[model samples]
Target: MPATTVLRPRSRTLIIAATVPLALAALLADDVRVRRQLDAVPPDPTSSRTDSTTLVPASS
Candidate 1:
């Protein structure tokens, strides 16, 4: 069986440096898309209330 190759700290650093910016940019772009979608949506007047308080009598 081959031993797991231990990555050097510099390689780890390079990977982190490569990926963090891409992740951050993706997050920011997704936020912008979500904001646009939210803006496009109209407010629903009935969404704040629920019918959970309505109850039926228990059967004898």
Candidate 2:
């Protein structure tokens, strides 16, 4: 009997596993810049008030 190697499924699994983390890392990598920009925006006491009654209604 001759020995045979199966390559297709194994290669496919490796490619899929590698791609998942690379994609997630790319998504999370953009958050750093986003967080930096968000930090620059001054927090408004009126907007962040826990009491909804404190929020000013926008005029139509």
Candidate 3:
């Protein structure tokens, strides 16, 4: 008769310990990539500056 092997609690703990760091690294890498992409984009100068042409003159 073949003996069945059971998973120990220590093995489960080891698996969790290994996976958590890898998951955190993947999340941090994605965040850095998104930040770099956002940084590469140029800001809209027209939107930031208020032009006199945009102001309406009040009639007395």
Best by lDDT: 1
**Candidate 3, position 21, lDDT:** 100
Model 2 residue 38 CA deviation (Å) reads 1.1
Please list the C-alpha lDDT of all candidates, in the order they appear.
Answer: 0.81, 0.78, 0.80
Q: Indicate whether candidate 2 or candidate 3 has the larger lDDT.
A: 3
Global local distance difference test of model 3: 0.80
What ranking of all candidate models by TM-score puts the best one first?
1, 3, 2
**Per-residue lDDT over 1-60 for candidate 1, one digit per residue giving the tens place of the 0 to 100 score:** 357987789999999999999999999999999888876776667765344344666799
User: How many clashes (backbone N, Cα, C below 3 Å) per candidate?
Assistant: 0, 0, 0
How many residue pairs of model 2 clash at the backbone? 0
The runs of at least 3 residues in candidate 1 whose Cα sits more than 4 Å from the true structure, single-residue gaps closed, are 1-3, 45-60
Q: Per-prediction TM-score, please?
A: 0.63, 0.50, 0.62
Q: Give the lDDT of residue 30 in candidate 2.
A: 90
If candidate 2 were superposed on the true structure by all CA atoms, what would the RMSD be?
8.2
